[model samples]
Target: MAEPDWDRMMQAAQAGDADSYRRLLGEVGAWLRRYYHRRLPPAMVDDAVQDTLLAVHEKRHTYDPARPFGAWLGAIARYKWIDRLRAMKSHPSVELDENLPVPGHEEAVSSAVSLERLLAELKPAQADVIRLVKLQGFSIMEASHRTGQTMSLVKVNIHRGLARLSAMIRSRNDAG
Candidate 1:
């Protein structure tokens, strides 16, 4: 049998032909997995492939029938791969604090004041590095690159700043 045309397959799939969709998915899945495998770890390839397929399925209606199906599929796969990389690098974890009660109005105001004081103790550069790397979730390399500072400088500033903050917090707690 002759090789199936991708545009035709996509059109047929879009028209609700189950077999065409299945064939398109099977053909694209392997290519997508290989694409993701090159950009990500082996363990993430399958997940990237699945996510790409689901995205393609969900967004199929938006696909311009005039465009090549592989290109559209590839674009979706690339987006999903990048998203997975970002997510894996900084995966959000939910911490359930059952023991910690929500702060009231007065507590919130006091906590804000305390944080301001704590941050104010550090020099501007140190404070900026701490805020970028610790508070803003940038990696040291990212902080350095974003701030135009050397990685070593960023690391030193963060370390010293954190030590100073710890000492200040401890002293305040002890005094209180």
Candidate 2:
């Protein structure tokens, strides 16, 4: 199948074409689903998709016709993902069945795969620092010593690496 001209469709939607607008939303929603499917927890995926769509709808007028539609949509989508993360952190879910054993092997592997994919997008230095500090539970000082980087550099790399990973997640067209 041929790819839709998202830029034109969005422009037409902005100009009050109801049919084009509907088509645009449909396509965008599908794209968002692919974008979030692996990134979010399974239970959170539907809510995240709906939240991102709502954000896109509310911010539709802010989209620039001269810019790439994917980039614009990605920016909004990334913000929505961050918002969801923040909300989840602030309101951690309660365990419904404390007596039930949590089966973590599959979840751990899935998370690791996703982490590696995201890490592959970063610079070697950044990726190394993140892996040592974030994934391996190394202190900044320990990561610095192991990586032969200054403590401050280790901290900086971790921060930049995570930020880049988050920003690039929405922009990548790997959903296919």
Candidate 3:
């Protein structure tokens, strides 16, 4: 029947009163859940509420005692809700792992071992260049830095290494 004393609760909370702080956060969280439910999907309401509450907890020190607590809380909640909406729009959820890649595992190890053996067939410099750039995902600049080679030399090694690897694979395929 009475309006909740938000300012008093918030002031008490700011003064280090644990019970009031807990009560304020609980009430705010409940209110935010209801507010979010009207605007967001059911699954998203709880997440928004939790995020808003966490922001409030983290930014509590910024609260000015003279200001209306509801306004401050509303500002935080509004931003959080908007952020959630933006995230939802930007990253629409997909039912991932419901269906696995399920690739054939029969030759997985043999393929890896075979690839390693193929690399080993090249000169060590060529093998190292290919492994650094192609296999290990290092940038050309990084590979050059790691191997103490110049940028031009790194490029040359990568080109030569790839050509050699292609010939090796082709020879293997032709023989097999």
Candidate 4:
């Protein structure tokens, strides 16, 4: 079958055409289902589609008639897909194998201790910025606020600190 003119349907829907709006929603739902099913797990596909549909409904007023409908729909669907991924990451539903060995935290702790020891070799300002912006994943501006330093200073400290750390590693390697 030929594809319907989604832009025209959406324009009609915007103009208070109830039947056209219903048809448009039905067609969009089908398209969204196909779109999500290919990317998400089977169990999550339906929820993703429904979430996209609701977003489309809520943001229908923002859709420009001059723009292609598919582009707008795709953008919303992509955002919803990313949201689903983030949610999954934050609360994974994977079943752990009982027979699988769980690694100890000793390696992680040792690495952290080694990193702190290396950071200590740098100036206090440089070490603070590197810890805040790199290790703790804060933005430069946030690090600046936390350290009472300007944004530019935070960036400079990070750059210098990393260079120093790299040189320290190289020197140790050459000596050993």
**lDDT rank order:** 2, 4, 3, 1
TM-score of 3: 0.50
lDDT of 1 by residue, 88-165 (tens): 324321122232234333433443355456668898777777667654557778888888879989877776766676
Evaluated against the true structure, the overall lDDT of model 2 is 0.70
Q: Ten consecutive residues with minimal summed lDDT in candidate 1? A: 91-100
* Model 4: pairs clashing at backbone N, Cα or C within 3 Å: none
- What lDDT score is found at residue 80 in candidate 2? 75
Q: Could you tell me every candidate's TM-score relative to the true structure? A: 0.50, 0.57, 0.50, 0.52
Scanning candidate 2 in windows of ten residues, the lowest lDDT window is 92-101
Q: Candidate 2 regions off by >4 Å?
A: 1-4, 94-112, 115-176
Q: Model 3: runs farther than 4 Å from truth?
A: 1-4, 94-176
Q: Would you list the clashing residue pairs of candidate 1? A: none
Total clashes in model 1, counting residue pairs 3 or more apart in sequence or in different chains? 0
User: Candidate 4 at 123: error in angstroms?
Assistant: 34
Over the stretch 92-142, how does candidate 2's per-residue lDDT look in tens digits?
Answer: 231222322355445445645776887888999998987776555567788
RMSD to native for every prediction? 19.0, 7.3, 21.0, 16.2
Query: 1-176 in candidate 3: lDDT tens per residue?
Result: 11258788888988899999898888887777656554443445567888888899889988898877776776676566557534532332312222122442323334345557767888787778666765455777898899998878877776676566555543442211
**True-structure lDDT of candidate 1:** 0.63
lDDT (CA) for every model shown?
Answer: 0.63, 0.70, 0.64, 0.69
Candidate 4 per-residue lDDT over residues 1-176, each given as its tens digit? 11458899999988889898899899989877666544444446668888888998899998899988877787777667657644543332323224223442343344356567767899999989876766555777888899999998877777777667656654452210
Model 4 residue 145 lDDT score:
90
Residue 82 Cα positional deviation in candidate 3, in Å, after optimal superposition: 0.9
